[model samples]
Structure formats: structure tokens, C-alpha cells
Target: MAPVDRVDHNVLERTSLQTRLSEDTNTPEEQLKDIIQDLYQIMVQVSTYDSAGRSSREVLINEIKTLSESLRTLHTSASPPNNLPSVPPELLEYVEHGRNPDIYTREFVELVRRGNQLMRGKLNAFGTFRDILAENMTTAMPELRDDVVQVVEATGGVPPGRRNGEQSQSQPQQNGANSNHASSSAA
Candidate 1:
């Protein structure tokens, strides 16, 4: 099979696994929650054992047995496949500290955006400096005018008055003028 096809197959397999895992675990999670609530109610009943009579005590025992069976089923069904990705340690630590994981995600994204903005600012500053220096150099040394223009063009700088598609038609005229200027300076 082609490399691209293999990669696509892998992605589809992983997505299918994840979807199956989600569907398989959801019911067990709900059952586990209900079991915990049932246990809590049983605990309250047991705590009032004296007032709860023999019939009530038997009912509590039956409920406990039912909950125990449910927990066993949940334990078996909720076991995740070994191929599943483990949770990130940082996210676990955040949750352990009682912080919301979404807040951590937001802060991380904000930090990355700020870093990108700083880099963009630096790039813009350098580009501006390049254009300004090229313009000044071309104007100050007319004898080296062609060389300066070549350097500016090669470095992706649009010379002054040459922006917006104006450079193409005027470039030959500029080259002729530069040659005349160089010849005059040499004489």
C-alpha cells in the first residue's frame, strides 16, 4: 500500500478505537455513579439501625449486595484497552490541585500567541530596517545605483516609488540612468 493510504488507515483505526472506547465506557460510568449514590443511602440507613427494624436491615443488606455486583460488572466493563493513550501528567497534576484543566489550556494558548506576536514584531522591524537602508543607500550613492537596486530586488525589497506593479516598466529606464550616472562619475 502507498504511504499516504497507510497513514489514512492508521488515523481511521485510531478514531474508531477512540469512539468505541467512549461508547463502551459511558454506561459503566453512569452505573458507577448510581452505585455510589445507592451506597450513600444505605450508609444513612445503617447509621439509624436501631430505629430501622429487622425488615429494613434486610432491605439494606439486599441493596448492598446489588451494589457490590454492579461494581464488579463496572470494573470489568470499564477496563480501558492497553493501546489507549495515557492522560498527560500535567493535566493530572492540575486536576489533583483542584484546578480546572481548561484554564491551563487557555493560559498555554495565550502564551503561545504572545510569543508569536513578539516574533512577528521582530521580523517586521528587520524588514522595515532593510527597506529603509536600501532606499537611503541607493539615493546617497548614485554611482553604485544599479548594484544597490539589484541587492534590494534580490532581497525582496520594493524600491521607493516601485510598489504596486510600477517596477516592471520603469526598471529598464532606471538601469539606463544608472549607467549614465556611473559614466559621468568615472570621468
Candidate 2:
């Protein structure tokens, strides 16, 4: 593989360009969201592989599950990912309203660029255990992706990249009355 910086830069540039799509890029505003979303997912897969490696992703994932459960007990602390991202005001207003077209004509975007950069910066973190995600993702089973993502969470990297499906699935099920509240927590 190329140097980590090279790979990371590629991913970062891809994400930035995807997220900042405008008329000059010529992608219709309607399609921009999906395009950015797809780009985000690709970056996520790369990040998962880059950060977690291929060996211990599943075990690391289980560990994160345990940690997440424990975090619920830290009365004075808060789970990190649940906080709203400090997106640019233009983005936030659209997000606040569930993508109401009337509210933000340029349309909406999930703010994953910063998360990707953070994940890249921490790509070599947590020693060898971090490689687990990459190893796990190269295997069979759709669930492999989940395991890799959980491992990323365990390493205390940024929340799962939405493009990679990591950020979205981490949310607890909204099986009850407050389903809407459970919505944005994934991002």
C-alpha cells in the first residue's frame, strides 16, 4: 500500500470535494447528498481498514459494546458521539428541520469531513488491536462491517463515518415513543 499519508490525503480530498459539491461541480443539488453519502461510506471503509486492521476487529467491537454499556453508568460524563456536531450554520439549519426543501435551497449534507480527518489522524492508534477492523472487514458476512465499526468506536476514534455505515448503526434502536430523538444520534 502507499504511505499512510498518501492514502489518507486521498480519502480526505475525496470527502471534502464530495461534501462541498456545488454547481461548478455540475452535480445536481438533489444528487449531491447521495453522492457525498456514498463518498463518506467509502472513506469509512478505508478508515475502518486503516485504523482497525484486519485481526481483532470483532473482539474490539465487543469491547466497545461493553464500554458503551459502562458509559451509561458514568453519571458525570456523556457519551461523546451523541453530541451534535458544530456544523456550519447553513448546514445546521437544514439539519434542524429534517431537510425541509423550503428551509435550505442548497440542500443538506451530513457533516462527516471532520470526523474523517480525526479518524485519519488517529489511524495508527491503539497499538496492534486497531488492526482488527481491517482484518474483520475483508471476511465473509455482512455483519463483518458492523464489527469493524464497533472496533473503531472502541478505539475512541471519531463516531462511525456515516458513509461507512458505522455512525448510523451505533445508535440504539428507536423501538419506542422517542424514535425521532434517536434519529440524529447516529451521526
Candidate 3:
């Protein structure tokens, strides 16, 4: 068979972009802004791919999952300093309720954008795994695959990793219902 040109144009572009971000960027903040934008796009693409029923884009899905996990880890590793700006309730309300706040900061926008990307990544990993499983199982048992897909969609996808029902039994329950009358009365 003659050699086929199976070139992925996006891969080349991504490599070039990474090189630029690392070497040509003027400051770390600029690099981070670019990364945040790319991550935002990735989360969007992952949603689009899943919605469009593109199960074959496993590599991209996995990359997004990994990037998301990494971002989460990095995000959680260090607590924000006490002096760092806190997200105001009004801004949060504006973002959550779709109200246009009169003023918003770039920092707030970036924080919210990163948070959204992380959430999508964390959630989509489970669905992507389910999709891969459903696709692989469909060839042999198409009907079962349909049922699997239906259940996954109906139940909003399965949680990842070893889900042990018995694990719940190991945890001892804390009974705080009958607290001291003083404590209860104080409330």
C-alpha cells in the first residue's frame, strides 16, 4: 500500500503555539492568559464534540481531560492569599443570573473562565469514558450499546473509577441530631 498522508493540522499548530507561549511570550501573565483562553476553547470543543456525537475524537477528549485535571490540581494546590481579590456577590450574581453588571474586572472574568473550564473537564471525563465503552461494545452487541447509551444519558453519566457500594459501609456516621440543649438553644 502506498503511504497515506495522515497529517493532523491542529497538532502542528498546537506545537507551534506552545513554542511561542514558552519562548516568545513577554511575561508569565501573558502566557497564562493564552493558556486560559486555550483551555476555555478546549472545554467548549469537548462539549461540542460530545453533543455532536463524535465518539472517535478520543485523543482530543483525553487531552482535554488531562489538561483539566492538571489545571484543577494547580488551582487547588495553593490557597489564594488573604489580600487577593474576592469575587463579589454582585459579580457572581451577574454571571450566574445572566445580569449585566455595570463593572467587572479582568481578574474576575479570568477566574470565572478558568473555573468553568475546570468544571467541564472534570465532568466530561466520565462521559467520554462511557462513550468510548459504548462505542467499543456496540460492534458485538448493538442493542446493549443502545441501552447503555440510553441509561448513561438518562442518568447523566456514570462516575469515574472503582465505585464500590460497600465503601459507604466503612464510614461511621456522626450523630449530631441530639446536641446539648444549650447548643441547640443558642442556634
Judged by lDDT, which candidate is best? Answer: 1
Backbone clashes for every candidate come to 0, 15, 0
Q: Model 1: per-residue lDDT, tens digit, 1-187?
A: 2222112323433353343335444577676776686576466546545553665565556556656655665777775876479777788999999999998889889989999999999887776676656656656765666787787788777654353335453465455445444533553
| Whole-model lDDT values for every prediction | 0.61, 0.43, 0.51
Residue pairs with colliding backbones in model 3 are: none
The digit string of per-residue lDDT tens for model 3 on 112-182 reads: 99999999997777666664464446445545744765666686753211122222322331211122222
What global local distance difference test value does model 3 have? 0.51
- Residue ranges of candidate 1 with Cα displaced over 4 Å: 1-92, 164-187
Error of 2 at 70 (Å): 47
lDDT of 2: 0.43
The RMSD of every model to the true structure, in order and in angstroms, is 19.2, 33.5, 26.6
User: Please, what is the TM-score per model?
Assistant: 0.38, 0.16, 0.24
